[model samples]
Target: MRFLGSRGLIAAAALAGTLVTAPAAEAAPASCAVADAMVSAGNYWLEHGTNLAAPDWQNATFHVGNLATVRTTGVSNHKTLPWAKANGYLLQNDPKRPFFPDFEAAGEAYLDLYTYFHPDPPILADLRSRISAEVASVAQGHDDYWNYVDALNMAMPSFARIGLLDQDESILDTMQKLFHHAEKEIGLFDEATGLWYRDARYVGTGTFWARGNGWALAALTKVLQVLPASDPRRPEYLRVFTKMANTLRFTQRGDGFWNSDLLRPWHYGGPESSGTAMFTYGLAWGVNAGILDAARFRPVVDRGWKALSTKALRPDGRFGYVQPVGAAPGPAKPADTAAYGVGAFLLTGQQVANLTPGC
Candidate 1:
């Protein structure tokens, strides 16, 4: 496999050595064979699929996303994070995928994916400036889609990590405004079933879209990660996060993945990777933060990792079963491949890595 950096290999090697001495609690479960599979799959993608020699940065977005997945999955080093950040300018400049509009969220996802390792100040500043401007302009209009809220929520952590809290207060305020819009206008809270509506137009009849809720769950988790306990909005964020988690936890399938239509399993035939990855990431983060019971949620994380590592990941590192890019939940097409799905998978993997000892 192509070496993104030495840290992941070194970490894995070190962990392997200590595995003999570590207590039972520290040893990965036999079921964690899924993690092994993910590592193998990710490495294959890095070595065979990525165009490391490509001159065009836009074309490298897939490679960059894959590398980020390796890092999050604890199979590669942190060096790829900086490489992706440096290449962000090129991604932003791509005429085909302009940085303006919702694509700004994609940039933020990359920034968040990289922040665990490479915390570059200048790049963070540039990202914050761009996000602030976009949020300011976009907040003025009315948006009914839940995914837009998810994207903006995904970006907030990148801003917080760089000490942009004070500078981005208006942005946070705008996010809060948007959350309320989702709540009141988008039918986020349904009275009949006591679940959030999938969208504004669909009332009680609409099931809670798994990816949409996943976006909300992830956004809430990301915001809470950096939001200080003293911040005025912290409590509200926590409440929303808890509510979403509770609602979704019961919807988890027996095999440990979520269906595309959260409440109606028959609508979409199988488990969805993007939404499942997001839930795993969110639930794991909640457990780590002491917001949820570790004992209760650890199994959820394990099951999610197992399902993702085994079912979605092919031996070649191509993540399958990912629902294609769309406005709402639908049947996953075989041809669908998405950068964001990989991003969500990596985010979940990163959380799992943190939980696993010596990884």
Candidate 2:
């Protein structure tokens, strides 16, 4: 029986067998070209969009990071611009969980396109509608749609980006409210550890999943990146960002990758690409943006990027050791790869390029 996925395409599940991994020595150049190498990966994936994972978070992530590469490397905006146009410039939908931020992941790409390549109304029409509806609903009652840490990375930046574009303080206000709810009422965050449990499951288990916290750090970085200078919540966001950076600085493995279980390495200890890339993106942005001290965090970014670009990256742009979709830590083998991991790699590359021009 022939099964079809979205738009009558092969189901995304079929791509699982098509992940294509290379030996650590294969596909890697002796001296990696940060922007060139990353965009090559972006270009490859964009060239083969059909062979990717779930559209909601995974491919959406690739778009966001690839667009960032386009911004930095001056590569052709050919693929994403047309891809966005074909998608009708709307936020991705998940009818089953209509309000879940997982579906909102793609909006980050839309917002990026709106900000840089095209400031067209069609690009933001759906984003504006959904965010407005959300703001109104939030005023009427409480919603815990952002109950998990992963959602923070997926949606908070979208809110902040839209807020910046429309100068809608209400949207920004609502974003802050939900974020704090996750931290306080939901109790997913531990200020003392500077890490957040992926969800309630790991809350008391002494397990701090690396990618989950990395997602949180990436969320904080993106939100702060776009938040207005006069915004009052800057202090809180900065506090969390810095605290996480400090904690991660100590947890990074000697070889540069972060173990899947950061606090407890034995809980599936190994190199995980996505989490390390997220950490690198956050730390590199922190140092480049002057939020992190060069003396302390610069080395961390350097080490993380070195490992990500060399170890995780195959010469042809396929990244390795990417933990597959899941909430908690698990083994991330050298052969495992994902587009979201590629996106994370791009995000880190752009910032790393900013810090070290020749990197």
Candidate 3:
């Protein structure tokens, strides 16, 4: 129950309730400062040990994103990198396992660490070798490998990161092929709404789960961050990001958050912090990249940051209202929290910190 070790702050935040709303708001603290505080506090709460490694994408994705957050925020070197290195820079899957995107998620952290500290370091040799072998053997023709929208976030960015690090452009081509296969062949992208379905269940329906699309948008941003402009796929990736940002702009809640289900606002009908945080991170990144119209998107990011800082955060810094891990939209209560949601908040805060005011 004592998530952040700051129950007093949590109590105060609970009483405050729904900190930021639209149409004229109080001038809040600077974005970077707020972001740094949340990241620091989140680290304090999660308390992941130095040697922990999970075989699933859920834990792997959060740590990778956490590394990004720490680097962006200028926090002094934290335990996450050390933990990753201590774990041998390996993902959940061994060479014997069949190809799966989630198993590749931890490679992002490994590559980030290798690039940041030392080049061609032995720390990353295992991951680099394993990924190369897997791609050679398993990815023969993009046969629906990345079937789920969330898997995009789990694996695509890692491929782009590793490809750029190794100067292997062809490896990047493989990533693009798999991405195109999922988005185009698998019926994931809903052309009309500019959002992605979690899978087949919500494809034709108007149900756009906020977190589902968040994974897609976040994955695209991560891929673009490292993807070269000369790559022929750049245009299509940019186009998809822009379209999703436009649709997200329209669906933002009056309170600056997004409902669990995007179109059916009343579905879960409450403040879902993880989805809101992911969108805030993606949209803010878009604005920083000049892919989104800053003037139009800035207010959306601002409201989201306020909502995150106020309603979602306990004064001590624990994130709240994160829906438990699920494939579709359902009930998300204010007290529900998870490590992935905390990662989403940290990622959002880091991007918000980078934004410059005014278009």
Candidate 4:
């Protein structure tokens, strides 16, 4: 996986000792087996590591991805889902302060679990109120509220999910408006490549930071999933997604991972599993959703899944090569795993499992 600097491989070996070797010879035979194993690795981390039940976005991201992993595999890790429900889906932030995107990210799991069951979930009460208020604020011309690209992953799906569940078109409408205002009006997207700048500063350099575009692509897939086909804004969402899907097509490394910076490969050049997993997740979802051509995206998904399993997934279940928490493109080592990185890995595995075999 072509990393950014001269020390990239040396750094990877130093930190992620797991990446230096392969799994046992008796590894699973089927692709689904690999996917299931990846899920198990994630469950192990959440269950045993310090990541479980944390209210912050880092842990929240993992839990949200945990939901997808369990839902797709039909195997719930008793530790995470029930714990989230028991805690009322909250973390370090108070419900009283709801506008922060990171605080609201946990609601993705809450709403998913709420929908998984039949009736209107009681757990939705607190989150619903906070999200509604936030959406209302944006509806009143707070279009640029999500100024950062990360906010898209942190909050977009919650709004779209709530809108779809309640049959409230206004909520979906306001959510789309806010996304366009931040991305398009703010000029975060590079029209030629279909990727996004990490923020306003990176826009000047037109750098396509991997995780930044990963957030945009993954969040776009989420928004497309919840928005009704009949909705007027659906086409615009698909258009944006197509551009991203096609752009990411050419930039992936030969080994299937992407560097920290998608465009400037030399910048912080190293295999970042988190960003690769997110792109894998988004691309697989696009193909599954029929928004992307299966013939075109299937190979990308296949190569990405290979890189993830071969290079990122350790035998002990520790997903590695995650970039530490940051707002922009930066260096990441193979051993540098984080909660959000595991989240992205699990989400990608979920979509990989959903893909029709031999596609």
List model 4 lDDT by residue over 1-359, tens digit each: 01112232233233223244432122122345645665666766865566455667787778767766655554556555676766766634654554877777778767655554323457677677877787788867777768788889888988887776676778878787888877789888778778888878877686778888888888888878766677788897788888998988999998899888887787887788888999999999998888889998999999999988878877778788888888877887767778888888877877787674521
In candidate 1, which residue ranges exceed 4 Å CA deviation?
1-101, 109-121, 134-149, 158-168, 189-198, 333-336
Which residue pairs does candidate 3 place in steric collision? 9-315, 55-92
Stretches of candidate 2 exceeding 4 Å from the true structure: 1-32, 47-55
Q: What value of lDDT does candidate 4 attain over all alpha carbons?
A: 0.74
Q: What is the alpha-carbon RMSD of candidate 3 to the true structure?
A: 10.2
Candidate 3 on 1-359: residue-level lDDT in tens? 01112332332233223232322222223354664555664674466422245535666656655665545544434656666766666676644555677777777666655554434467667666766865775456535678889888888877776676666766777777778878887789988989999986667877778888889988898888766687787898889998999999999999999999999876889899888989999999988889888999999999998898888887766778888889898777877777778778877866776673410
lDDT of 1 by residue, 1-359 (tens): 12223433333233223223321222223355435554554555455544443323222334334554554443554445545555653234345433333444434434534343343445455556665654665576744323343443444444444333244566666556656666666656654443455555556666677786777677777778767677787797787778777766787888888988888889886878888988998998898778988887888888888888777877667776778766577887543545556657766765776677645
In model 2, residue pairs whose N, Cα or C atoms come closer than 3 Å (at least 3 residues apart or on different chains), thus clashing, are 27-315, 28-315
**Model 2, residue 122: C-alpha shift (Å):** 0.5
Better of 3 and 4 by TM-score: 4
Model 2, span 1-359: residue lDDT tens: 11121221211112121222321112222253776668776776665545543446887888888777765665654767776777787766766676688878878888777655565668878878878887887888766878999999998998887776666789889998889888888888897788998887777777898889989999999988766566798889989999999999999999999999999877787889999999999999999889899999999998998899888877776678999989888998887887888889988887887776444
> CA RMSD for every model?
7.3, 10.4, 10.2, 11.2
Model 1 has an lDDT value of 0.59
TM-score, candidate 3, is: 0.84
Q: TM per model?
A: 0.72, 0.88, 0.84, 0.86
* Cα lDDT listed for each candidate: 0.59, 0.79, 0.72, 0.74
> Comparing candidate 3 with candidate 4, which one achieves the higher lDDT?
4
Report clashes for each candidate as comma-separated counts.
1, 2, 2, 6
* Model 3 misplaced stretches (Cα beyond 4 Å): 1-32, 48-55, 94-97, 118-120, 356-359
